[model samples]
Target chain A: MAPTFTTLGYLTAGLYTASLACYLRKLFAEGKWAGRAATLLLAAGLATHYFALLVRAYSIHSVPYQDLYGSTSLLAWFLVLTYLGLELIHGERAMGAFILPLVLLLLMLDFVATPHAAPAAPARGSVFALHVTSNILAYSAFTLSFVYSVVYLVQDRLLRGRRPIAIMWRLPPLEDLERMARSGVWVGLASLMVGIGFGMVVDRQVTGAMLQFDPKVVISFLILGFYVLYLTVSRSPAWRGARASVLCVVNYFAVVFSYTAVNLFFSRFHRFY
Target chain B: MSVYLLGVNHRTAGVALRERLHFSLEDGVRAGESLRRDGLVDEVVVLSTCNRSEVYSVVAQGAAQPEGGLERYFCSFHSIEPAQLNGCLYHRRDRDAVEHLYRVAAGLDSMLLGEAEILCQVRETYLAAQRAGLTGPILNRLFQAGLEVGKRVRAETRLGAQAMSVASAAMKLAEQIFGALKNNSAAVFGSGAMGAKAAQQLRSRGIGRLWVANRTPEHARELAARVGAQWAPWEKSAELLAQVDIVVTSVAGSEWSLTREALAAAMHARGNRRMFLIDLGVPRNIDPAAAGLYNVFLYGVDDLEEIVEQNRQARESEVPRAEAIVREHVEKFAAWQSGANAVAALADLRRKLRLQREIFTDAHREELAQFPAEERERILRLMDELVEDLLREPSERLMKDREVRERAVLLRDLFGLNAPDSSRRGGE
Candidate 1:
């Protein structure tokens, strides 16, 4: 039997929850096996989440990100997927404790919003799907960047303080966190740029206009400006590390606002719900 | 034969006594060979480090007895008086010796808990002993098990995983900023002891470029030459600061050598590249406020010490886990040791049983001569089967039982199967 989107989403939630538990245990425990277990569980969760999205897309006969519930799930999936890649590259699993909870939170929100999703004609066309998918993917990337920034601040504070925080050693180095965050932003920025480009094409095709004053479009451009400014000033000596991290962190909130409030109320053509 | 250990470590002796008792590699080889030649031990390995000097050996059961003799030999080899080792030297035998060596190799017995150097030292000593032909089956298995214990403890616990010294802490912090120092440059602001140590550490890390600057050009040049670094003029601090990714200052005096404003200016010139400042001076060479500057990471001696303490605590926290891993490996080695000993005992049992069969056959030779040759051969074959059937269960039990060693010993005693003395048998 074909699984419903809600069922698949719940399955991902369970896996992510278990993965989060392993990560938390790893933080307080001395055993490296916990870290390995956590990464494996997260990878398993990511696989399940991907399969869930495919099932949703198959059942609906359209891309999964066409609706708010599915879009949130996709975003959660991308966040974990990106984090797994970073964890693999860095060979650090401590960050998973921080990243997986956000993933679970998004999944929870998806579960809450799933029941309210109305039956409607599935959104069609590859460009529109590309527009939505890339935008969500960018948001996922930025979310990870924000988490890294937060960790960077905590590590910096811990390093600066007189007392030695027990968990501080487990956290990644301040510069490593910053680098990971920067990579997150760059990947996000590039993805967002592509999303916007596709959005423009979709706009022109649908409305016979080259541009629109849609609130989502404007706010995305503003988010783009925030990251562009971040990338530019972060290279400068006076603003590179902590200041740059703070900038990206604040920019991520702007991304959050645009993804939530702007999409819900103000954005006209960009509303998926 | 079993493992035996005699040693003096930081816990039991002062540095003067330890140094007096210390052995170089040549000394270790000589000692191992002399002990083996003199029939004191069948096999031997000497583990000597700054904190401790230990001799691990495989001696015949009960031979290392009167343990004072081994202690006296150790003292005499180093030309130290037995009176000097009074209450300072320790001795362990059999399982205790096995556990002690495991603990030492795993760094639990280190002066600094979980220090990694001992593991390498242990490995080197074992390899040296092997190269010198000082080890046999028993010591070979024991040292192999010791190395395995070290690796398992390291892999399974957080012990030896964190930087526990000030210099190491500084390197850790630097690595935090620059993932790998091989691509980064550093400048040391003084050529004093602290500065020299910092410069040496930076060079060891393979920093791309290093600059040593001091008030006296000669001192700076000497320090630079020692570390393969460039000697920068003391006046060129700003230019050095502008170019280097890291700055370590240990300049003397109450006056700040690198002030906030100067660092701010350097930051501007470098276009705000990230910089790490390690202040190892008593009076503090860099301004405390410079840490507030963008991309400038400033750490003082206190901060580094804090990191070291934290690391120490972290390593300390893993002790129970590391000990558990050590215990697990020790038990495993014990099982294998017993099994190995049992294999020998089992062979002896088979030999004794066959001897008994041969005796019975010789006794029946006159009776067999009266029967036909073929009938006599069949009767002999039947007697062989009877002996095999009688001994099969005990033989299998000796190999498979949990108390195989005990059973083997019991069997040897009951059958009067006295094996050859281990002293004559050497390591096996």
Candidate 2:
């Protein structure tokens, strides 16, 4: 018998957990090999995650973003991808200890929340795939922005409090955190705008509707607006550091609301799966 | 022979004593040469820096009262009386000396832990000794191993990662703000000593453009010329603020030299590009409220102190790991030293065996001359192999067993290997 998506998903979670342990070792102890080990494990976890998504897509004969479970899984995959990219670009491994735990949590949630069987109303077609993929990528970028914002705030607090802990020493510098946050916001805002555009196109194609009054659609646009405001205000001298980080955090909540509350409670016509 | 280190460092000696004992490069070379020339030490290297003065030497294994002689020689060389240097000196022999040298090279023994200058000092001292023809095989191996252990400790531990000084703390903080300072411009807000030091540190880290601003334009220009930076007029603070990526303020004053409003206006005009402000003043030259402004990272003396203290603590925590590396290398060097000691015994054994082989060949000279040339060559080859085979076990034992190595000199004496007439005895 072939290996199932659920098993591969569990394996991905295990790999991520191992990677997290290695990253923590690197952060706490002066282990020479721990960093390279952590990077390798994270790369392995990413590969397993991609394989799991592929398995799901093949088993269901549709894209992996056809349901809430698959979309969350894709978001987790993108988060790992973005983190790996940052790690490669920066040559810094300390952030992995903080990031891999979030990846593990999302993967575990995907496992617990996703159904064993495919949903009756599957989100099919290339337009739906493009739309969902873009949205998940946007959410993933937003999630990374949220993480960087939290790091920035924590570093700021540590600096201002005049209490430099060992963990604070291990963290990336405040400026690097801020730059990473800004990059995340830029990518997120662009992906979100493109996702909304594709969502509108899919909406018109499927239901002959121009502007649906769906809560998910409205909240996503609201989240977009929040980030657009963040991008503008963060450029000004007054709102750059703590204020900008707070704005990113606030926008992340809107993302959580759209991903969960709007999909579970309020969305009807916008529910593609 | 054994390696020995006799030294005084910042921890053991005050600045007065250290200054008295400090050796310049020329003094080090002269001292190393004189020590070796006087037959006091087989090999010697003298290392002297701001924080330390050390004599690393190789002496004959059983030399009587070597340490006392070395101590007296060190005192007299520096023209210091023994009474003045009695309590300030430390002596380590053999393994302890090796470990001390490794620790010094690795910066563990530095006043500022993990400072990198000592490694270069170690290299220079070794080179000076070598140029003076003072170092032999043992000192060469010890110094080379010391340098390697230093590099390994730095590469394998976090001891060398953080900044321990105020100037370095500023550079580290600037690095945090701007990942690389290679393309960044900085303006020093005063022509004070601290500002000049900070500017030098920044320039050392590859700051592209540097500006010195001061209340006295002439002083600013003088400092700029001294440090190879540009002098910006004192009244051009706002323009400098708008242009530079870093601003180091060391002006002595009670009032803030850089206010929040002024920085805010500058930030607005600069389109909120990221800027780092290092306030080295007591009352804080940059206003604390300026940190609230966008893209302005303001670190005062207290903030830098926190970072420096934390870094010092971190380096202290890494001492055990770095010491472990040093200890490992010390043990390896000790083993190599032992193996080196066994080399003489092995060579003596080979010489004795060759003497025995020649005696046997001479006794059978008539019988060997009766054989053909090919047969005679084969017999000589057999005798060479037999001698080698006969000594292989003893040679292996000499390298591995301490008891066997101790008995080697007895065996050499029994075989008359050290006698001047031993080779002629075989012919007689």
Candidate 3:
């Protein structure tokens, strides 16, 4: 059963990445053919990804939030969901043309690392479900913010260089990217807020505090602080674009360190494990 | 088929000559009627712009000798000496006419080569001709394709990206001096075309004040009124010259003017402040000898033209890409035209098929008269269904095919349904 899900996850990730790569090439050249193909590929990939997530849920039962493996899969699913939601609202396929591949990459890394389900993982409960879901969704928003920040960096560079209209025309305008980054930070904040709420609830229902004061937790708080500062400064207009992008980039690395790097090496307090 | 275009342009004729022969909107309306009236052309379209005025026409394949009445009509209508105008004029017929209009729209034929305004001017001229009821498919297709080509080039090339025109170059010079043109004052010499254009450019640059000085006071006043600039008489050109920091001159006047003596006094009064001077006059206004004076910098049209040429070359690099788009649109338009022509041919075929069906039904009427009524009705239904089935696909397919469009056009001519031009324009 693990093999079935593992294989589906691999196939879905490969297909999703291929779709994004193909669409990116088309958008840079002949927009019409690429536009049509990108939409179709995204829709198809989302369907397969949805199926794989459901299969993983059933195979493990209890919503697949066990340790590193289940949480990684859940985060990957959240990323895809957040992406599709934005795509539906904006009617812009370019975001998916950049985003889905990143999501797939994270999932693929999780697959290769192949973290086993922890024996100490909790049993089925609404509290655990709510805790993992909120945390992963917040991480998903961070993932998206990270993507736009990188795009903003490149676009801002080109705009300053006095590029011809066509070269940078493919990207969303600088103003649009800034707005998208702000929204991403807001959503990430909402996810962190809910995740923290669920953690307290879990602490109450279980014997003691299930979350340890691990280095990973501290780093996660610092990352959350950096972005909150970013958002607070963003209201002032002085802390936008490059300042915002830099903060988002740092936060993205913090997520990587907290979720994957610390889980793989440092300590045993990884809640997923 | 060869189509030639002939006209006097800004390069070929002086401003006085060009202004004298310039075609006003009303004159074009009248000229459109006269070109057809005098039987000099089988079809004619006139493209008259500020920089150029050309007549594009489709003449007879072979002709009997007749007076060149269109030429005579143009000269008499303008009340100009035929001898004086004839030397400046050029004539291009056949393919040249189409290519010239295309080049004009592409900005290749303008005084400022690769400028964008000519395309819009061509469209206006085409519409004016059309309104006068002087246009046919050949002219209509040519102008429409030319406009498309213009759009294609601008989209695919760096032509518009480069700042090279005299007006744009002057703007660039201002940008260099002021860093930003939020509040600069500039004096423009000679209220002629280029000077007026330069003053307008200065105003657009957000200049705080604009002054116009011309060889003629009324002309300067006219230009100043148009551009909202203060006018100075030509004799006081030196006295008022010290007031502004930037001076742009365009004197397509009869002789070299604005000597070293005139500018030296102005520079002395200006207290050695840096002033940019651009001289666009062909007869050499703001004499090169004036550059020795301090606080005075002067540049000529050739220097400006070189910059524009560089811009032109940059634009030329993008030509292939733009031409590719043009070719696509040209083919697309041709396909559309073919499809349109097919409608007529399909109509004709349908009419013939219906007539044949009627004749076949009539001939069988007698044979059916001897049969029982029920059998006859059944046979007639079969015949009608078969004819409908057979005609439907061929007619629709023929209407859809591109190759058949030309054949359809030929067929229309053969069938005597080549409706008159009036009905065509009125959408018959």
Candidate 4:
């Protein structure tokens, strides 16, 4: 069962790599076949990733996000799922080349870490579960926002350079990339706010204190502040486009720190097996 | 029998002379009917477009020379003198005629190489000639072959896949910027032909709102009504500038210009929303300096020309592939035509043999009267058997070998089988 889970995981990652290749092909070529191929491959990867997680949970007789490996795997799956939804909604796939690399990186981290059996941890209440779910959703949306922001900058640069290269035609226009990046931030901010509220409730119930000053908790709030400031300032006419895109890209750094360094190395209570 | 083409295209004639030769759909059908009715051609089809006017016809082997006749008739019909078309008229005969029509249908012969409009024009002209009863088996097969060539070229090559015109490039740029034109608005300055065309292109893309303004208010109103758009006062161009996502200016000799400062102010007023400006005017309508402003993309005639040149180069690379496809189809058409000609020649030979047998019996009728009626019938059956034996080898060779089939015309001439008949109308 464990080998089956590992095989499926590797297959999902391989499909994602292939899907990203297709998108990159589309970026430099004039054809719809590549775009269609990319979308189909990405969808297949998402389905396989979902099935792998389910298999792991079934074999362990517990939820999959009990440890850092399981949670990072869950984050990668959600990131792909969210990006797929965005592709479908917007009818755009050029962003896939910019996005699937982060997904692959997350999977690489999950696979390289020591494989562990299901943790025999204390039971988590409904509030703790909501906290984890919201945080994962927030992180997934922020990752997508980061991808959109980067694409926005690329598109902006191409437009500024005024070169009629094939890839410039493939990328979404500046206005569209800007709008998607902003929308992603709005959704992430809402999810993160709900996630923080749930975390506070769970923290009070578990440690009898609403505030723990854990590095992860402090960085999470800091990430929340950075995005809150981004959304507010981006709405202004003077700072709406390139400046806004730059801010979104910058804010993702704080999100990365909160999710990786603080949660993995510094947080005591937030530690997973 | 031969296929002949007579026409003047953009390559041979200037626009003034080309337009004179141009025919409306109705006029084309009439011209075809008149030519056929005059016994100039056994079958005829006329193709008239903005760039060229062509008369494609299948004529009897020794029919009246249609090239000179068509040239005179074209000039007379358009109330011009024959001398006016002396250097402009071009004539193609036989296989050359067939290949020319294929090239035209495939858009290789168009002014703008690989334009899609030529294919549709060719189709519509063929159908109209068909409807007018002016096309017979030869002309029918020729036009059908031409249409097949068009479809194959489009399918096998990317010749007509890109935007190769200024208006089309503008629309492509708009799509890139707005992602979807359905939610974007655009304004057109000046009611000139280019501006009107761009406005129509935008509307056809389902642009959210379209505003038309010109120096002449009534002209603006009329153009707006034509495209089902709103007409704004020319003075209010600045206000419209702040609202629309796109601006196309083709106002000729206009003193007014959208300066960098004014456009910057508009960008500020519109919350820094991106704006695309296309200046199609010759002397330049919009300020070139405005292109440097953030969120403002301004393209003049030169920039649009650059895009068109890029597309043209891309299309040019596919020309060899397109020509290869056309050459393949042309060969297929030639083979089918060869088989048809061979069948006709064989039929003509059979008819001539039967006629000779009848003449011999008539001349010897009295002497044969001495025989019984059954014996006479047997003699006729023997003649028929000899004719069949003589034709069997020729029939097999003609149908089975392309080289032999192509000589059907020479065979007809060698056997003195050149009497005027439908078989004489077979394509050579």
For A29-143, candidate 3 gives per-residue lDDT tens digits of: 4345566676667677767777877787777664666655567767877887787777677665666667876766667666476556556436738876787688889988998
First chain TM-score for all predictions:
0.94, 0.93, 0.87, 0.91
Best by TM-score: 1
For B1-428, candidate 3 gives per-residue lDDT tens digits of 12446677887998888888888767876876887787666556767778877777754323332236666777887897788886788776544555566767877667765687888788888898877778776667777788877876665555545546768865764554343455567888887778878888888778888888877789989999998888877777777777777888887755747778877777667654546678888777787877655435566777666655655676667656655655566565556555555664556545655667778879888887998999988887787777678768866666566676556556555544443321132101
* Colliding residue pairs in candidate 4: none
- In model 1, residue pairs whose N, Cα or C atoms come closer than 3 Å (at least 3 residues apart or on different chains), thus clashing, are A237-B271, A237-B272, A237-B273
DockQ winner among the candidates? 1
For each candidate, report its DockQ versus the true two-chain complex.
0.49, 0.35, 0.03, 0.33
Model 3 residue runs over 4 Å out of place are A2-52, A55-101, A107-122, A151-180, A231-245, A267-273, B1-21, B59-119, B144-316, B329-428
CAPRI classification of candidate 1: acceptable
Question: By the DockQ metric, which is better: model 3 or model 4?
Answer: 4
Specify the CAPRI tier of model 3. incorrect
DockQ, ranked from best to worst: 1, 2, 4, 3
Residue B79 error for model 2, in Å? 6.8
Taking chain B only, the TM-score of every model is: 0.86, 0.79, 0.54, 0.81
Q: How do the residues A1-273 of candidate 1 rate in per-residue lDDT, one tens digit apiece?
A: 133455666777887888898899899766777888888888888888888889887777667766776778789889988888888888988899999878888877754674554446444478877887888889999999999999988777655553447677678877788888989999999999999999889888888887899888889999999999999987676677778889989999899999999988998866767
Q: Model 1, B1-428: lDDT tens per residue?
A: 57888998999999988888899988999988988787777789998999989888876543435366677789788888888788998889878989999999999998878878888998999999999999989889889889988888887787878555677788877876577798899999889988998999989888999999999999999999999999999888888899999899898887656889999999888988778889999888888999888777888999989778777777888899888887887888777777666666566666676778789889888987999999988988897788778878876886678686655645556666554452234224
lDDT tens digits, residues B1-428, model 4?
A: 67899999999999998887889999999988888787778888889999999999887764567777887788878999888887888899978898999999889998878889998999999999999898888888888889988887876666877655799888888887778898899999999999999999999889999999998999999999999999999989889999999999998886777788889989988988778899999788888888888777777777778888888787788899888977887788788877877787788888888999999999999988999999999998999999999999999988689999888767678777766573663544
Cα DockQ of the candidate 1 complex: 0.49
Ordered from best to worst lDDT, the candidate numbers read: 4, 1, 2, 3
Over the stretch B288-394, how does candidate 2's per-residue lDDT look in tens digits?
Answer: 88887756777888778877887878778888999999989987887667666556646656877887889989999999999999999998999899888988898
Clashes of 4: 0
Backbone clashes in each candidate structure, one number apiece? 3, 1, 10, 0
